[model samples]
Every structure is written in structure tokens, then in C-alpha cells.
Target: MVKSFMTLAVLVLSAAGVYAQDIIQVQGTTPDLYVMHTVKKGETLYSLGRTFSLPIKDIAAENNISADKGLQLGQNIKIPLNGANFSQKADAASGGAPLYHKVEAAETLYRLSLNHNKVPLDNIRKWNNMSGDGLKKDTYVIIGYLKGGSGAVAHTPTPTPAPTPAPAPVNNTPAPAPVNNTPAPVSNNNPAPPIENNTPAPTPAPTPTPAPAETKPVASSGSSFESLYMQQTSNGKNATTEKGPGGWFKSNAAAGKYYALHNTAQRGTIIKVTNPLNGKYIYAKVLETIPQIKGNAGLIIKLSDSALEALGTNDPKFYCELSYEN
Candidate 1:
């Protein structure tokens, strides 16, 4: 009886360890840096709030659900990671479970750092035991941990499943015979007479006309986010405007998908960014707040590198005007 009890206890502990390891599966990140979470059985808004260190009401408003409504199992939700709740400081490890960002296609280490509130690039390397800047798609990279969550960060890299080999195509079409374009060789035994042709001096072939130079199309200053901006402010409920110095960061987002990091605008809010120097403008979506780094001090906004180029500026910092719906 004693041996059976000991065996049962070991099995329960092993199961608990497995559960903890699988608890934090990252779905994806929002434009504003919020991580998506799928609701699990027994997870209430109140409990989620406690787990993520966010106010219950904030979570409810973010997902457009009533605070009193219970979360359904497998329902998707977003966990906000603003300055108020998220942290990347080395000391923050003591407070929460590590949060991870699943690397997407063409995502670079530099872009990853900028997306995650500009966490130090070295810190990211240290956390994942990465020896270089390269990252494979679908690899989970630790961005930071939740401030009040449980469990230690398991640094074990998620194994990427090997891709299945595609079947070789079978070709049934026969290949065409090679064309012989060489002229026939003359035989020395049969001396052929040379035929002289006077075809009117070949009409002095007209000088070939030079083709016109190709011109590259100029990139438009317009942004695809413009429609989103218009829709967001169609009601004009919380319109706000500001003009100040703006900074820029590298991004892998497609051209014209301009994005920004502002201190006050809510994530996903579209802001009209205009370069006062040249009157160039673009509508940029706010991702999150400008990271509290030394060089970022005093900047009103941070634009993606593509957004800055669309604005027709090479300057890393420039004066700009912004209009957005609160």
C-alpha cells in the first residue's frame, strides 16, 4: 500500500510539470504589441486579470465584452502590455512568467526588439541562448514575461517539425530536337565560283533609333492606412492633434502599411503623420508607446522606416504633425 501511494504521487507531479510547460502557447501579437490568448476552461475575466496583471475592466473593454460576461472556452482575447503592466527589466523575471513572441517569416532580431517595446537586443539573445542574429520562422522568442503570472521561463527551444518532401513531378512530354544553325562546309575538291551581289549597297541601313530611357515610377506618399483612419474618425468622437519631433525604427511590414509608436494613442488607432518640411504625409497605425530608451526621449511619435520613406524624408528625426481619433 505504501509503494502504491508513492507511485501515484510521482505520476501526479509529472503530469503537473507537463501542464506547466504547455500553459503559455503564444498565438500571435497585435499591431499594438498585445499578445492574443485563447480562453481555456475555468479561466474567468477576473482570473485572467490577476494572471496578466491587468485590470478586469481594461481586458473587457479591449475585447468588446462586458466585464460581467463569463469568458467561453477557446474564445480568443488580447492581453494588453502597455507601460502600466509589462516589463522587460532584468528584475522583472522575479515577478512573472516569461512572455514569448513567435517569430514570423522574414522577421529579424532587430525588428523583433523594436516590436517588443524596444527591449534590448542583447537581452533577447541572452534569454534564448542565441549565438547570432538569425532566427528561423515559427521559433518562439522570449520578449518578456507577464508581470504577475506563475511559472519560470523554460528556455527550451520549440522544435520545428521537419517539412515533408514534395513528390517529384513525372514528365510525359518528349523534348524537341535541337536545331542545327551552322552553315554547310565547302569542299576543297569542288572549287565553287564566287557570286558577287550588288543589292543597291543595301540601302545604307537606316541608323537604328535609340529607345527612350526607362523612367521609374515614383512611390506615392499615400498610405493604405488612410481608409482606416477615415473610418476611425468618421464619427469624430475623440479627435486630437499634435505636432512635434518624430523618430523612426526599422520594420518588416510591407510598404505603405505605415505604423507608429505613440505615447498616448491607443494601439490600433490610425494617425495621420505629416512632414511639415515637405508637406508629405501618411496615415500610420499606432503599435504601442515609444520605448523609454535614451535616444527616444522628447519624441512625440516613432514611425516605421517605410513610413518615413513614404513621407519623403531621410532624416532619422523630423518635425511632424499628427491627427488621430482618441
Candidate 2:
């Protein structure tokens, strides 16, 4: 049997001719970010947990693999990144090993920064010793560091094939011809004699009883979070408020459950977001700090797309107010 491999940008180290395991890529959004790694010989769930500074169970859960089962050579898996395992702070260098991001096509320095938790552009340049904003394809840049890892890994570039073109659409069946159902018009040239008596007209049919109107269940307006918000602010201890431009990001959270990212609020902090224009509000839990990218500059908070929809606005950026416990 032939073995198949999943190809991606592999992370490697090239210091004094030393090569390490392959780090495939980084994916997902804040608080749910992950690093893709390829399993190698002698590697186990326990070893990966230590290398990425993640819990063994978390790695297993992220990949949906059995912790007791051994990882196959060349198999790919995702290593989850949370507050405990990943850092984009200035002091990250002192605490963790560097995690490299391989530059892809059409990627700009600004976009790269946004994708990697909005680490400072200047910091990325300094780390990579770059003087200009231009990034060449296949170049590996240091976006941030993985906390508590011991080895310093760099990237070795690999060639990627061009994407194949899509096939043209084909139509197999033809449409059927239209049919004429109207009867031929009666001729005026031959007038028929009048017949004597016609049968009694049929009794009028009874009108149909109208069906009851359907009552569709209405979607919740996210009022469930109100109880939690009230409990957090009942005593008014450590409460803070701010009003500014708000933004949103994509998330897969269940309906009526909102989440946000704020620069100052700590993770798991429940915040009350209000749209002053419409007087609509919702309570959202903070996932992490908003990435400090140029696009997010001056924004107070970023909510999930569902939360924004519940607030009754489709504008990508809108004016809003926030209240939360410090």
C-alpha cells in the first residue's frame, strides 16, 4: 500500500546544520489558535505536550485522536494555543522558544501581524532583522514564541506546486417542449339549433375552512446573558465603562452565547456591550485582548459576528459602549 502525506509549510530549524521536526502551520482565531505539527519517529502525545507547552489531553482533543494510541510517522496534528502556551508580549523572548510563521503568497507584513495575534510590526522586523515591509514568498518569520518550550526552531523553505485550474461545467439533458391545452374556438359560420332542457345546475361547493396561521418560534435576542451580567455588577465592585468604536470577528459560538476580545479586559471577563444608536445590549465573555493591529486601533472591543448581529447592526465598525468588571 502507498502512503499519502498532507503537504503544508513545514517549520524547521537551521542553526549550525541542525534540523528538527516539521511545524506545518498556524490556524484558527484568537483563544482558539493552533500550530500544525507533523509527527515523527519516537514522538508521542506526552512529548508534543512538552514541546508546545500544551496539556497532553488538549493536543489529543484538538486532533480528535486517542491519547493511548501511538501517533503514526508523518501524521499531522494541531497543537492548541491558549494564554498558558502562547505569548506575543515583549517579554516572550525571555520565557519561551520562538515559533516561526512561513510567509505565503500575497501576504503583507501588516496582515501577517494581524493573523498572528497582532504582534507589533516593529517587533516582527526586529526579530527577523528586516528593514523593509516587503516579504518574499516562502520566507519564515518569527511571529511569536511558544511558552515553556526548550528548543529554538527556525524554518526551512520547501517548494509548493501551483494550484490546478477548475474544470468547465457541462450540460447533458435538454429541456422538454411546451404543450398547448386551450380548446379550438367555436366556428361562427355554422349555428347549431337550441336544445330543449339542461340538467339542474350542481349545488355550489362549500368554501374551504381556513387553516390556522403558522406560529414560527422567534429567535432569542440574547437576553439570557443579562442574568450573568447583573450578578457580576450587583455590588458594582471593580466595574469600568467605556464608549468607542466597536468591531467584530468570526466565531462558531452557539446562538445567544456571545464572546468578545478587549485589550484591557482579562480572559473570561463578562462585558456588557451596548449599541447606543438603537439602545440594544448583550453580555459577552472576553476571549483575549484584541490584536493591536492598525485596523483595530482606537477600537474598544471586538465582538463575535453573531453578537454584532444581535446588537442590530451590520456595519463592520459601529459606535458602542462597554461596561465590565476590571
* Tens-place lDDT digits, model 1, residues 251-298: 655546777889898877889887777777778877667879899999
Segments in model 1 whose C-alpha atoms lie over 4 Å from true places: 1-15, 23-31, 151-326
In order, how many clashes per candidate?
2, 1
Error of 2 at 294 (Å): 16
Determine which window of 10 residues in candidate 2 has minimal summed lDDT: 161-170
Per-candidate TM-scores read 0.43, 0.41
Report the C-alpha displacement of residue 92, candidate 1, in angstroms: 3.1
Alpha-carbon lDDT, every model: 0.70, 0.69
Per TM-score, the best of the predicted structures is 1
List runs of model 2 lying over 4 Å from the truth: 1-25, 28-32, 152-326
